[model samples]
Target chain A: MKKAVFIKEGQVAIKDAPMPEIIEQDDAVIRVVRTCVCGSDLWAYRGDDAKEAGSDNSGHEIIGIVEKVGAAINTVKAGDFVIAPFTHGCGHCAACRAGFEGGCQSHSAATNFSNGYQAEYVRYTHADWSLVKIPGQPDDYSEGMLKSFLALADVMPTGYHAARVANVKAGDTVAVVGDGAVGLCAVIAAKLRGAKRIIIMSRHEDRQQLALEFGATDVVAERGEEGIAKVLELTNGDGVDAALECVGTHLSTETAIAIARPGAVVGRVGVPHTGDINVGDYFMKNTIFAGGPASVTTYDKAVLLKAVLDGDINPGKVFTQTYKLSDIDQAYKDMQERKTIKAMITID
Target chain B: MKKAVFIKEGQVAIKDAPMPEIIEQDDAVIRVVRTCVCGSDLWAYRGDDAKEAGSDNSGHEIIGIVEKVGAAINTVKAGDFVIAPFTHGCGHCAACRAGFEGGCQSHSAATNFSNGYQAEYVRYTHADWSLVKIPGQPDDYSEGMLKSFLALADVMPTGYHAARVANVKAGDTVAVVGDGAVGLCAVIAAKLRGAKRIIIMSRHEDRQQLALEFGATDVVAERGEEGIAKVLELTNGDGVDAALECVGTHLSTETAIAIARPGAVVGRVGVPHTGDINVGDYFMKNTIFAGGPASVTTYDKAVLLKAVLDGDINPGKVFTQTYKLSDIDQAYKDMQERKTIKAMITID
Candidate 1:
């Protein structure tokens, strides 16, 4: 089997690795069909966040075919095509029961994939609850449907988490604070939740166009104070009813908070990497700040899978570029240099 | 007429002031029947918060009789007994319509009281919406009922706001940080919302006893880390489902956040006076932080008034001492020295 490895900052390589096998009673081994590079993965690739050199298991999202299952794995079995949520859970834990599988308490590690899904084969622990079986094999679905199914593993669900936490409702005016794939997905999420007006902040023309296509009603190219001013102006100086913060930076977070109307919520889904947050500002407006890692398993089972199957949302459009497992390095490079919105990788 | 004035740190004076008249068509003049000292008022009294010397509008809460009304004040008129919420609103602005009167726009100031409620006569702005009419005159209710009506003006509703923001549900576990009048009221708020276990932090035996009487099931005397540990231990390490922050200090806020379970909300109603909040901690737990000044007008008209009128709650018990208007200085002194939980002033 071959897997992606992080050699150092700005460098990734696909190297031969041992084949994955079920090691626990609840485990299952799957042959990877599709995987992708995440914006979060870029944190380490760009040297902004540290990762040990020569580390494998470089990616988390996976749409694969289950090849084998341990004794206790009853929900999914061999020959089943599945979507594996990046964050796994036991489904029965208190947190999971409450729809927060990312904080599942019964698992030793919420995510238990051997050698990462960015490989020819991967082992998933607590397989019964972590993997969502598709109605048919990969061969039965169109290429576009397959891409949308792949998105359900993380990005689409993560973006939906922001809208859900913000309680974006019908007739709401929503503001999205990033132009990344997750932000574009959030535009869809906001629209799905019936938000009447969606304003997206995006400097890149291609990303802005995708956001508009994803249901964003307006676009503000400005950043920081100017961006907040632009959003407030768009909303007639009343600020947005809900703000989705998909960028994990102080300025982005600040802009999200600043553009939210009094008594509105700001749902932040970006992995935080910012300085002190002035809670006083949130306090004054009675703004509710809610969010964290996406509950991928819950959302995938409840909404995203159905939405994708029905072709109600085309989240796969976020993938502007594609590659094979052998070309993993160039995939990372293209995403890192802003040459592509996202990279989709296919493995055989 | 006599009104209380801030003389300096640790001092208050009852001085003769001019009679208040309705300046705006939306204003009304009331003969203050009962008023009280608040925990927030203590900030300026202790010199921790700045206030201009000799400021005469030294208080906000009031239970009074409408003695005069401007042309536009139709809902409340002369001879009506009313509860004047400290935070006034026009009742029709977007923020007010959404039940956040503290952020009400269209008014020059959300609070519009002349010469303070502690005076013999107080003028209220946006009178039609700011005043909740009692069924009968002051003479019709007992002293305890009047005290509770005054409590509805601020502390009771403010504490209820904490519980409301946290979304306390049936069978939930709630932890309250702060044991002042507002915190004590939060215990009642939590119980009213059907919390199964209500834990309150209080070192004072007097406050602890009152909290228990009000519906708190557990008491943690420790502060800071120990307090958080004690709460976690009580909940079997799962932490409380809702944490109500009633004390506006960094340590109090930190304690509230630390004892909340994953996906829980920390409802903060304390007037914030702290440094940067570590939003990263909140992010890791998917905790939602929401709150601001209580929507007293909304709560008073919708719930607190009926609750008090029906004798369903006795929030007035928080007022442990009584004083005549002439003893305004003594009221501040006793409250400052911790000799009283709250001071109830009678104007004759």
Candidate 2:
């Protein structure tokens, strides 16, 4: 089987790898149908993540068909269409039972001992707790519908998590800091959550257009203090009720904090690259900083699926570029070059 | 008039100062009936806050009798017994209207261009917005009642703020990191908010006794990782639903985060001395970090006043040592030496 491998800094290639098999009682073998490059992947691709330059599995977001299920797996069966969250969890753990599968006791994202999903076949452990089965058959969904469903595995749910943790409510004024696919999805999530005014910070015209289409009431094209000034101006100097830090940089987090109103919450879903935060400023403003990794299992994926199926949201629009499995290297180049918001990979 | 001055890094003294008078239309001249040394005051006393080594008015917490009111003052008048929140605000500002007076547009804690409360007579700006009147005449309350009311100025309200921001609810298990008066008050606040179990981390037997008396179900005598381990063990390794960070150090904040359950909130009211936070660990746990300087003006001071008046809580008990106005230096020394939980200063 062919899988994406991290060749070295600024390079990636396709290589033949051993086929994955079910090794645990709750494990399952899945044939990858669709996957994508996450912003976090850029860390390793740039050699900044300290990952040795070698052949290693990449990509965590995946939509696939269960080719085989372990005998212990009861909730899902072979031939089922499934969506795997970015992180896996053991079903019966206290954290999982409390609806925070991201903090699963036995199995978590840190202990991803299995192979990545950027391959033809992958082994998934704790299948009963980690995989969410799609209700309908593959024949019942269109190509776009399948792509949108794939977002439930990571980005879309992550955006929703940002809104949920920020306690975004009806009539709230929200600001999304970043123009990437996740930030755009946050605008949609805020809108879906009933935010009355959505402000998006974007520099690109194309991303701005998508943001507006996704329900951003306004867009601030500036960066740093100027961007915060624009948001405060839009909010009549009071700042937004909620701010979503979609870009993991310190500047973005600072901007999010700057534009949040007193008692407002700044929800960050971006993988933070910056270490320290200006806690002193945060204290004086009386703002609440919330959010981290999205607990996809805790989110109401079923409701989101219904919303997608009913044509309420088209998150697939974020897939500005697409590529066949053989052209995975080109996909990475396009994403790294900023030519695409997100690169959709077709593995089947 | 006389007032407490920050003469040097390790010293405080009572010195003659000018008599205060109303300067702004909404200002008031109040005769400070009582005042106290706050835990944060030690920051400046210890030379950690970089305050100039010269005479500058000190304390912020005060209960007083209105001596005179400006023409624009409507909510309060001369002869009214009142308590001033630690921070002031323009009641009409967006932040003030939203119940976050600490972030008021025209007024904030930093712009204390006005005089401090540690004086015989001090001018107060935004009198109508900053002062909350006691229900009855000054003569009707006992010495303990007045001290408890003074606690509402900062410590009690700040503790309550921690629990409030953490979203402490009925049946929740809470852990308070710190054994100071504010931390003990947080234990009381958590109990009042209906927390089923309250855990307080304290090394001092006196503080632990106060914590237990204030409704702490368990007291962990350990510090740092050991303290967190004790809390985790007490919670059956599930961790507490809410953790109040009453100590403003990195170790305290880390311990608070470590003992928090997934989806839990760590509410911090301490003036944070530790700069950066471990965003990576925070993200992996799916925890929410919320809180800042407690908006004392946002709290329902009337409820706290009533509780004190009715003998429901004895926050005054935390003031184990008392001194007359002329003995202000002794008060500061006792607090500086950690020989007292808090110091009470009688101005009359």
Candidate 3:
């Protein structure tokens, strides 16, 4: 079957690869249905992350149908539509028990996407804690409906957790950095959390329009100081009560810290590439900073999943472009050029 | 009247000065009843903090008798014994109302300790919100119970606020960084907050003994990695649930971060003196780092004052040495040589 493999470096291509096998007792083999590209994916493709020795697979955001399950997998069975959230989480660990399953101790599911689909089939270890089964029609779930919430497996929920960790309360104003798919989702998530005003910082016109529709009360097109000034102007110089920084670059992180009001918080979900992270800049303001891997298992997946079934938040708006599995490289190009917010590939 | 002046850098002397006079409707004149020297005071005496052009006065923690009140000072009577919490607070800023009165918008009254006592009397602006008056106290309150709850003005409440801002919960294991007066106070504060295991990292035998008396479950005499390893070994390799960093240097800050579990929080109250801070290595741990200046006005000063009155918590244990006003220079030297944890000087 075709899988998106990092053939050498700096490029991704769909090529024939050996199918994954269920070696773990609680593993589940998922037949790929729909998968989306992630921002973290660019870390390797852009030569920002360390490259693998032989070949590396490149996808963690997966929505698929279960084709097989280990004998211990009673919670989910074959022929069910499901989403794999976080990377992998052991059912028990100090972090998991404390509701921070995203930083699970014993598993490296997402980081080891070598076992995931950018392919036709993916094996999920600790399947009981990894897979969330979709309750509705298994045979007829389309990208429109699945993308609305299935994407919550990672992006939507991850960004929402960022806002939540920053303690975004009702009627509080929020500043969302990086106006990408995750940033737009955070705008929607902040609105869901009852944020009275959400200001999204973006340079792209299409993403800005989407941000406005998805509940952004204001938009700042400028980057850094100019953008922070616009946010301060909108927030009456009091600065934002909270910020969700989706882009992990130093620039976005600085902007997030710059725009937040003292005693407020910045939920930084951006995966920092190799760079110095400054926490002193936030000292006098009393800002609370918390964000790492999204604790996807901690939240009630179905609660957010319901917002989709109720047709309230259209997270699928981020899926601006679609392609077949064979043309995955072009999809990466669209995302790299910022021409597409994110890409959805049909993979039945 | 006489004033204490740092005549030469690192040297303090008593000199003739004028008595303080009320300058505004929110002002009050307080006769210095009792004052203690903080480690921060030694910063400028040792040429650490920024020095003003030929400036005098260093003390910020003062317990005094209100000698006069302005037209708007309705909170206390002229003859009241009060705790001067801030250098000054307007009591109306957003930060004030939200209880972060230390960072009040009009920061005029924030830290104007240059006009502080090293003198017979001190001028207090915004008397209504800046002072905490003891309900029942006789004249010469200093010689008797003045030292009891007065730590609430700065050290005691400041230490507790450091733990509180991180939202330290019941049964949490806490690590206290720094062995200064504030660090010892943090041991007491974290204990009061119901930390199950309180570990004090200190090399000083006196401070360690004080920490044990203040309810420390354990003590790690090591400083950096050895100290962090001891703390982790105590917690089964999971590290502390919360950390209070009372020393603000990069080393102390890193120590606090090194000793907490993922999702644990570190509340820091010490003011950073120099160098950039780095938390990039700590990003993956998902720790919530917060804290700044102790918002003494933000906490229940009256409640804590009552606690001191009830003899439930004795904060005066931190003052290991005493002196007359004439011997203050020697007191500063005693503190610098680490012979005393804190010094108490009497004006009379």
Candidate 4:
């Protein structure tokens, strides 16, 4: 089976990799229907071995049909449609019980080659817990926004979780840093969560425009001091009640902190690389800093799936382009160039 | 009016600073009855120039009797008894609405010591919002463990808030780093929150013993990697479900992270100085980090006050010694020398 693998630093390729099979009684083998590039996947693609790395099947945000299941598996079975979150997790791990599905303990979800998630057909472990079965076949798969659901599977809920952790409230103003898909998602999320005003800080015109559509009550095009000042200006010089950082860069993280009013919270979901996780401003501001990776598995993914299924939300807007599994390089280039927000690929 | 001012680092003396008056339409003048030395005070006492030179009003934790009120003030009036949390707060601020009362906008409890609680007669700016009045007590000053409430005014509730921020649940195993008053209080708070097994990481026999009395199921005297190893060993090598860092040192902060299982939360209430706020392990461990200066005002202090008042909990055990207000120098010395866990100074 053709699968994506990281040959070395700065290289990703679709090569003939070994097919996967059920290893646990609660395991199932899923034939990949679709896969996509995630911001978290860029760490190794960009030669940054800092945040996460692996060569295994590189995609966990998968939409697939279960090809087979173990004898003991009961929740999901052969021929069932499902949305696989970024991790294959055991339901019983402390981390799993604590409401973090991405850190599932039983089945390693990283590169099976090294610790990747991209593959043709990969073994889905702890099937009862890891796979979210999509109910009743729809006439149009694209209409279902399955690709978007795959995308939403992690970053979307992550944005919402960031807001939840920061405890953003109704009539409160929240500023979002980093106009990545997650940031864009957070704009919608903060609005959905009842924030009276949502602000997005970004220089990208496209993202800024998207931020507005997604529910950014305001957008700050400035960076650093100017950006912080702009946020405070929108917030009556008191700063935001909550700041959501969706971009993992140092500048974005610090802006989230600097723009925070004292006692407010800064929810950071961006995966930071080599940079100071500054807490000096964080301490002086006396702010609550919450958020890590999204606990995609711990909470109910069905709610998000239903939103996508019902067309109430269209997260698929993030996938601005697409590619065949073999044209993975162009997909990477398109994403790196920022010409595309994200890319979807056909596994077949 | 007589006020206690820090003339310089390590030099504290009572002097005629400024007459108490309403600075804002919402201000009030409170006749401070008892203001205790807070753990956070040691920051300024150890020569924080910003505090020493700015507004040397030394305490944020105070129990006082309201002497005067602005016409607009409605929460309390002349002769009302109250306890001020660590920071002066305006109840109407966005930060306050979001439940972060420590960083209120209308009244900044202590921006600098230019205005402080550590004075004979203190001027409270957000008198309507910042003060919590004691119920049913006008003259019974010495009966309700006001000193303990004052002592915990910052640390205890701060510790409780730290655990709350970490999202500790019943049946969860939690590890507490730091054996100071905050740390000790965290042990009880963790138990109150239904933590099944509370572990205290400390070398001090007194603190460790107190932790046991406070409902800690286990105590670890080891430090650093070894201490973390013990914590992991106790949890069958996975690590505690939640960990709290009440001591804000780099070591304690690192240990809190080290001992937390992936997907677990490391709630750090410790006030950090210059130290590596390590995220390398956190990014991989995928630990959720939350907590900063606790929002004691965000919690039900009255319930805690009742607990102290009813003697359901004896947080007063922390006050090992007391001195007359004239012997405050000795109180500091006792606390500094570790001869007393905490010392109270009485004013006649």
Q: Tell me, by TM-score, which candidate is best.
A: 1
- Model 4, position B272, has a per-residue lDDT of 77
Could you give the CAPRI-style class of model 1?
medium
* Candidate 3, B216-317: lDDT as tens digits: 989899887888888888888777778899988888888888787777788888877525666556667787888876677556464577677777778888
lDDT of candidate 3 over A1-348, digit per residue (tens) = 778877544578877777777777788888887787887777677776777744655567777788888888888888887877755666577667666666676666444222436778888778877677778554566558877755777778777878878888898889999887888889988998999999999999999999999999898999978988888888777778788999888889878887876667788887765277656766667777887777765553645777877788888889989888888877777887777889887773
Which 10 successive residues of model 4 chain A have the least lDDT summed?
A107-116
lDDT of 4 by residue, A24-111 (tens): 6776888877777777677667776543333553445677789999998888878888777655566687767766655555445442
Q: Candidate 2's interface RMSD, please?
A: 2.3
The digit string of per-residue lDDT tens for model 1 on B305-347 reads 9999899999999999999988978988899888999999999
Supply the TM-score of chain A against the true chain A for every candidate structure: 0.97, 0.95, 0.93, 0.89
DockQ of each: 0.59, 0.53, 0.47, 0.42
Candidate 2 lDDT over A1-348, as tens digits, reads: 988888777777788888888888888888888888877777778667766656664588888889998888998888899887776767566677766677777775655323467888888877877788888666678989888888878888889878988989999999999988889889989999999999999999999999999999999999999999999999889898899999888899889988988888888888776567755457767788777767675564546777887899989889888898888878888898899999999974
Q: Each candidate's TM vs. the true structure?
A: 0.95, 0.94, 0.92, 0.85
Q: Give the alpha carbon lDDT tens digit for every residue of B1-348 in model 2.
A: 988888777787888888888888888888988888887777778887777654564578888889999999998989999988777777677677766777787765665223467778888888777788888766888888888888888899889989998999999899999999899899989998899999999999999999999999999999888888888899888899899999989889888889998778989988887667755457667778777766676574536777777888888888999888888878887998989999999885
Which segments of model 1 are wrong by more than 4 Å?
A108-115, B50-52, B108-115
- Deviation in angstroms for B155 in model 1? 0.7
Pairs in clash, predicted candidate 1 = none
Ranking by TM-score: 1, 2, 3, 4
lDDT of 4 by residue, B1-348 (tens): 655555555655655657678877677787776665666666656665356354564556667778898987998888887766665556677767756666566654454112366667767765666667777544665634776666556767877877887888899899999888888888878887899999999888988888999999999999998998999899987788889888877788778878888767777777776276744335545666666666665564545676666766667677777766656656665776678777665565
Top lDDT model: 1
Residue A309, model 1: Cα distance from true site in angstroms? 1.5
Scanning candidate 1 chain B in windows of ten residues, the lowest lDDT window is: B107-116
Error of 1 at A339 (Å): 2.8
* CAPRI-style class, candidate 3: acceptable
